[model samples]
Target: MGLWDKIKDGLTTDKGEVAEDAQSQADNAAAKAKEAQDKADAAKKDAGQPDAPAAPAPPAPEAPEAPQARPADEHKPKRKPHREYTVVSGDTLSEIGARFGVDWHDIARINDIPNPDLIYPGQVFKIPNK
Candidate 1:
């Protein structure tokens, strides 16, 4: 009976050791699988080919454009003569127009006045070139 009990105790101890060894092996396998996945990711990055395409390089800066030459006539417009007149006391549209050698109707039209007889003292009027 003593030998039988010793044999049963040895068998129980061996079973426990076997379970521990199996658990250790499983942990090592999991660690190795993680290391392999990390190495594969690093290799993909080093190859410069990711899951998505790389962004395109920005376009090269454009060169400044040269100034264009224009014709001489483009700088000159048709010239018109302008005259300045100052209003005096008791001045009317007829008197101002006669003094400037222009018709009262022409004066009123050029100055954009609603009433030809509404000229007042101290107002300046522009007489247009005929």
Candidate 2:
């Protein structure tokens, strides 16, 4: 029946019988969990949603994958050398940094922009070497 009742029965019954019953219950639980997971995966695929733990599609080979141990952005790769980005209206240095995978302060140092907030449209920013 229930887990508690099963446990009680297990405690009072022969060791072999209790072990057999417990094994059966565990197998049934495993089967149920597998069925539920399969259904969820099917629903996600039907709705055009990718599996959370799986890559949506294989990405470019040169780009490195996120390491399992570290997730901090600081560990992300730096921007390639000599790349130039033009400042657009409403663009902030922080936004630019995120796009190029570099630190905002690094961009400021390379461009010598006294205030990262003070960039004007059509101004060019350089992405320095890693």
Q: How well does each candidate superpose onto the true structure, as a TM-score?
A: 0.37, 0.37
Residue-wise lDDT of candidate 2 within 1-130, one digit each (tens)?
9999989976796889879999999999999987888888899999999865532577767967777785687678865666999999999999999988989999999899998778999999997655
Worst 10 residues of 2 by lDDT: 51-60
Model 2: CA > 4 A from native:
1-80
Each prediction's number of clashing residue pairs? 0, 0
> Residue-wise lDDT of candidate 1 within 8-125, one digit each (tens)?
8777767788899999999999999778777776788899856333344789999999898998888898765768788888899888888878888887877898987788877778
Candidate 2 accuracy as TM-score: 0.37
Give residue 102's lDDT in candidate 2 (0 to 100): 88
Which run of 10 residues does model 1 get worst, by summed lDDT?
A: 48-57
Global lDDT scores for all candidate models: 0.81, 0.86
